[model samples]
Target: MKKLWNIGIAAATVCLLSLLNACSLKEKNVAVLSLDKSFTTRSGFEGLLNGCYNDLYFLYGKEDFVAPTELGTDLWANVGTAGAGFTLYDHRLVTTDGNLKVIWGSAYSTINLCNTVLYYGKEVKGYTSQAELNAKLAEAYFLRAFSNFILVEEFGGVVLRTTSSTVEGVDNAPKRSSEKDFYDLIISDLKFAVQHLPVNQGLRGRVSKKAAYGLLAKVYLQRTRLGEAQEYARLALETAEELINHQTQYGATLYTSDNTRSGFGKLWAGENNKTNTEFLFIQAVEHANGYNPEFWNRGRTRQFFLPDLGGRGGEWGAREGSPLYGRSNSRRFKPSRYLLTQCFEPSATTADTRFAESFTYKFYANANKEITNALATTYKKDPSVVGYVIKGTSAKATASVNFYTQTIEEQTNMANDAGLAVFTPNWTISTTDKAKMPMMVSDPSDLFDPATNKYKDPAAFPDEVNLTNVHPALKKFSAPLYAQSNQYWMGDFSIIRLGDIYLVAAEAALLYNGDKSKAAGFINTIRKRAALVSREAEQVIAPTVVDIDFILKERARELAGEHMRWMDLKRTGKLTKAYLMQTNPISGELFDASRHTVRPIPQSFLDAISNADEFGTNGY
Candidate 1:
């Protein structure tokens, strides 16, 4: 047992947990009631089930909860550093850390709700069909499995709570279960989900049979090390192939051609987030209201890994209107040097459509917007001396423009599409071209120093402007409309999608056997979809040889900030060391395999438990 969270259950506990916001039947996204119903009617049963799903919003969209998953990963670091700092394993990452407490408490709360559903669901009688009743129960099973899956992966070898927390005190089950026990329960629940869950849950964002299959595939791949590693890999491959082979049956298709007006940018272009068929499962939010609008307003997936664009005076529009620049969020998880250099520079010879789609390569201007020197300096505006921020100055760009891309090439005739700011970290844009361009330019030399893990000397820009102001921004979850006052970018968060499934299938085959060709084929399915149409052939892997390293790299390129990098590294034994090591540098620098794998048991939970000494902190 790495850690134990005494899921002390009581009526008061259930009531207190229920007080949190959840999906409403009135909304278009995930819908259900607050579960005031006693599960006597069909609506009551569904409401209770939906409440179980609500916890996901607490984890996924919430900032503190996301810190553990994204901040300490290989692909991303703090917005200013070359590698991760505190979240990796600094002293600040303690047992009393609020983020850890929130995670442990939230997961157990969701599990308790599922347990409550299983206990009282039989009383729910208004079923139109047997499948409906089965589906309802299956959803409960899946939700429980999902929460426990998070528990095991995060804290390791947790107790499997089946029955509702009916007692008035702590759950009597004290001993922590084995990792195998946790997976057995997870697999059993998911198998039931596969058997009963419909292809379409009918409501948008509801988990389906296909969603269960995708999740099952990922679980098996992670479960390889416990025992029967090869067999688990085979099961993973088999399950993932089911989705890959017959995606149409499950109402899914990968966005292959990123070519229309914005090229690969169409995939995450905000307008198409709801209609993106490639999403197997997502935390889809409505355009207007998501969950309880006011309370859930903090639920955000925007501006993280995004550079401080707001600081650059209103080059990009303010976030109140549509087609505007995304709002200034507390941007965390800056891209690591590895991600910028090794990962997405057209990894193959082909023009990788993903680089343009994965990031925001261009920024537009906000014409006629007033600027103040004081506001400019307060905003930490880069190039504050420019006309855009300082006002009446001649340095501001006037139109939407890009640095290296052909969208807005050259300094001449840059009328409707002008460049206010350009970020060309990899490109060696010549001084002549840069001078001719109308915007402030930030190349690799001007931004944060990867080797030093520090921002470059700011003497080049205005006293208020620092080079850290310029870097690549992740636009995958960007939604400008979702960024108004009281609105965090509440767009649909793609949890397990078709792109990730292809990689799962690829990795599973290679792990099951040395089948590089089969793995390459699976990977190419995604690569081709991510490539420029004519150059698709060039994006294909040679298939001569493939290994875990290649698979890991592909996963990083495809699924970098999708809330599972830590698990990917952990499951593969790649998480080791506590400081910079030659083998694992960016993410795993502070990852101590012994203690860092499983987080510390929340002290609040420990304080409540009677067997405190017997069940000590999980080696924190």
Candidate 2:
């Protein structure tokens, strides 16, 4: 089958406009491709709907929406100097920040596209039947609701624009709607979607009826979190169970562990990545077809998880550009020590495979492979680096360099391994013993202050702490093996998956009624999938107890880089300094719950609208 995202190119030929009638709206300040032109043909209408999802690539593939959702939260923190402004929540995170502007603009643009599609959908021709037309309309509904949900979550109660921002229904100086207004449209949209969306769209990145049910469950739960209504928890649980119980019918199920690869590992890496049955909603990109590099616009989101593994002289810089360690740009975000220490619990007897699957602990010697493809751009070779000739992709590493989270005993024995370079362990090691070792071993004491959960300042140490140099290489996104480049890489970004739905079910069950037993059943399913070989039973909970906090931690463990951390903390009323100090303490102290919970509305947006005074800077 032809890939879904080639809609724009394909539209030019198959869905040519019979008549061009573009309308301008003062509100959006962008011309809407008139529905009359779009609905002239079924292919044209399909192109219009797919255009609604095209904005998703701009939002998801870039740092705009990802930073708003992931940074300043507990699971992830800024590395080096790039995101300190937003991560620390200081003067840099103000309304004028480019990222803030991008978030607000991209969302509204997507919403406008959906509104246009829905407004003139009935006029669409060449549909085989009412069922086909309803399914198409249902997709637009999901996109509109999805975009609005992001708006409401990021910026509280926004101007509700149900009508297309075209000449047909122009409302130039619209005032902001209440949260109730947003949820009403959102609920209505999803209910319509659930009634009409097909069980299987048979295309990656498209939403299904199961996706509608899943998202509705979350929407209701969010309403409860916003203090809108408490009775909605029942609805949330019921909707979540509707999707959960009918997984087999919907052709979705959890990936189970095989002898060779764990389910969690298989879910992200290997042959089944883009086609994984678990993925419900995604921003999928087909290889080569998705090679448009509008100044670094490729899906380099995987680069966010890596350290700046730049070239150094010794084993520390052994593999500066290996596909195994994966390529990284200077702007990267590493996992918090709080996330590494508190959330993951891997024991020798009952190993947690999620810890291993999510992070990369070892660095292979870079073989300086030639980048033949022009699109696969990489950093230029550094003069001072010590990389070897190309070896088999997975050949043995001559040296070991890592930021490993290990037991003190494991560290002590591993410290004896030959050619161990730049060893930084989480557990404490003695200062005297460190000097005697052949390798440049780190004093685990210098890793972080156990009291504060903050990393030690580089200036405070005798040897400057290589904070950005040899940290763990995050591989959950599983950087592509063949064509390596930080400039552009085609990787699929998952927005919703079955693993998250399982967590939602557990959360709703506990929140709706204190059904700890019911919550345990849902959570244990995810834990079992993450458990190591022969230890699935050890990962099980006894159904003795569960709570909102436990659900948040499990989410952190399971879906860290999938981008929903800041919202998770805020939704559960745990965005307080107390919670941050205990968990993500670096910026936890810098956070001000008074204003930090809600991001400031972009200055560009405020300046653009006639009702600027009404939509102030969100108390910025």
Candidate 3:
């Protein structure tokens, strides 16, 4: 027998339908329960209401998990097996497709759950905490809008469900809502949430009024509602700037330079929630169910480092090898070359400290651990710095120079330890392999095998890990300085940051005030932070007015790989054009632009519906 699940319509739908009829029996039941529910009670109605909160995990954690954002835009590099399919636009994914479906399905699932809660919530009588109940309800509204934002952006129009469709004879098939209407609902919900939610949250992961306003600004920006965008952006700036300016302990800050074991590179090292203020929404990594970093490291029995396939190590390291080596089964996300390059002036020689801070390829190696020297009853105190040399065949060759000034035995040991000889072109010491450097510590350091190693005097030792690889490891989300491999619990992912908002405001001022200098100032501000020579020095950059097209591209360069790429492209009607790299794997060719912009709606949805016309835009 075919069974029909009575999933309720959205809260909006209930309100709309309520006007047509005074109060249906089902509606009365829900309304009565809404007014009677209690936060502390374990009643059936309260449990269902609590279920609405569960929708948040699905909304923030799984639905838009870092993959889509990372791959959609060019901010992140796709080095692992998981990225190959998504980055290239192949839907043959076991995990990602499931993630997409969860995003799609979870939105509607929560809508129904919210509908039930709101309906029953209105009628419930568990009193004394009206403020708490209202706050919770407001959160529910914000989540529903947030979910819809993803749906409308990814798949376009979606069935605007508002109330539970539990009644046996109630029509379950709802028509697709227009995009404008969808945004309208989203804005309305966020506005209401801002009014109701507290500015501060007791828990780290919970959303606040500031977050609501911040998201509202984003929605307005996407809709091209400049005035509204400005208003929301200003509100967000006011709310968050204070917290940031105070330099409160709540927010996370990167250490540009530090020598402690828990230094700049190991930010994501521990289970401690150190930087929560800046993180608006984050996926929590459970104590036992944390991410696996070992799966991506090199020379491990479990997984050989990058450029290697399966058990056989490859020529170049795979994209994620540096950060994940010697770690657990999980891996860290890496920003892309396009992202790094975009922040700089088109000229390679451009100087920008802000851009420089994004990455550093210089360091002083600790002599004790990296290598050893034998001299008069004492070894050299530290390992010498390995300077970076760019001596590839051509400027674009992207190759590193191998400076070999070592004895045959020293070179041979390194090669043997890495399962490859020192003469091999791609054999290089990685950030994780710093401990393997005999010169990074005392002369007779723990890093070297004394029997086969030379540095004998244990007196002198080196102090920092120097840069050796052409591609330096990222410091952005590194595990904190002292954490062991398995400590990567959830850290906050900033969907919106103060830096980006400044850019947005600058663009808005240029558009609204015709002040090109304002926009240039905004771009320059970010550039200055990146340690790059300011665009101000370039005559071409100063006169560059904030054209919509320029702003869009700038957003791509600045925010690529952060998960906002596809939506921005879609909003600007450039998704198809930007996907110039959407190519086929087997054939190794680009996909037709017309067929690549939007994915076909799930086949199952079309097949289940009796009339395809009723569903919505079929990309027809």
Candidate 3: residue 204 Cα off by (Å)? 1.9
Cα lDDT of model 3 by residue, 253-370, tens digit: 3322222322112322333333543344443322222221111111121111122111111111112222222222233333333344443333334443332233322212111121
TM-score of each: 0.81, 0.84, 0.59
Q: State which candidate, 2 or 3, has the greater TM-score.
A: 2
Which regions in candidate 3 have their CA more than 4 angstroms from the true location?
1-50, 53-67, 70-96, 127-132, 165-172, 225-273, 284-337, 344-477, 481-489, 520-558, 578-596, 604-617
Candidate 3 lDDT score relative to the true structure = 0.42
Cα error, candidate 2, residue 145 (Å): 0.7
Count steric clashes of candidate 1. 5
Residue 496, candidate 2: Cα error in Å is: 0.4
Considering only N, C-alpha and C atoms within 3 Å, which residue pairs clash in candidate 2?
Answer: none
Give lDDT tens digits, candidate 1, residues 1-620. 00001111122235242212221223321112233354667655565566676656667766655677765655666654322334557655666877777788777777777877777766778888877788878887887888888889888985567765431223432568888999999999999988999988666777888888888999999999677989999999999998889989988777766444323445675556776787777765554433432343644555555556565524433222222334445666666655665667733233676766677655544333333455444444444333542112122223322111121112332354443444544444564554444454555555555565434556644653454656666767764434433225656777888888888898899889968899999888777777667667767787875778778778877877778887887777666663234322545555666787777777776665556567667777
Q: What is the C-alpha RMSD of each candidate to the true structure, in Å?
A: 8.2, 7.9, 14.2
List the lowest-lDDT window of 10 residues for candidate 2: 401-410
Residues 144-167 of candidate 2: C-alpha lDDT, one tens digit per residue: 899889888888887777766542
Give each model's clash number: 5, 0, 91
Model 1 ranges with Cα > 4 A deviation: 1-37, 80-86, 128-130, 167-169, 258-264, 290-299, 310-323, 346-350, 368-417, 422-436, 448-465, 480-487, 578-580, 583-589
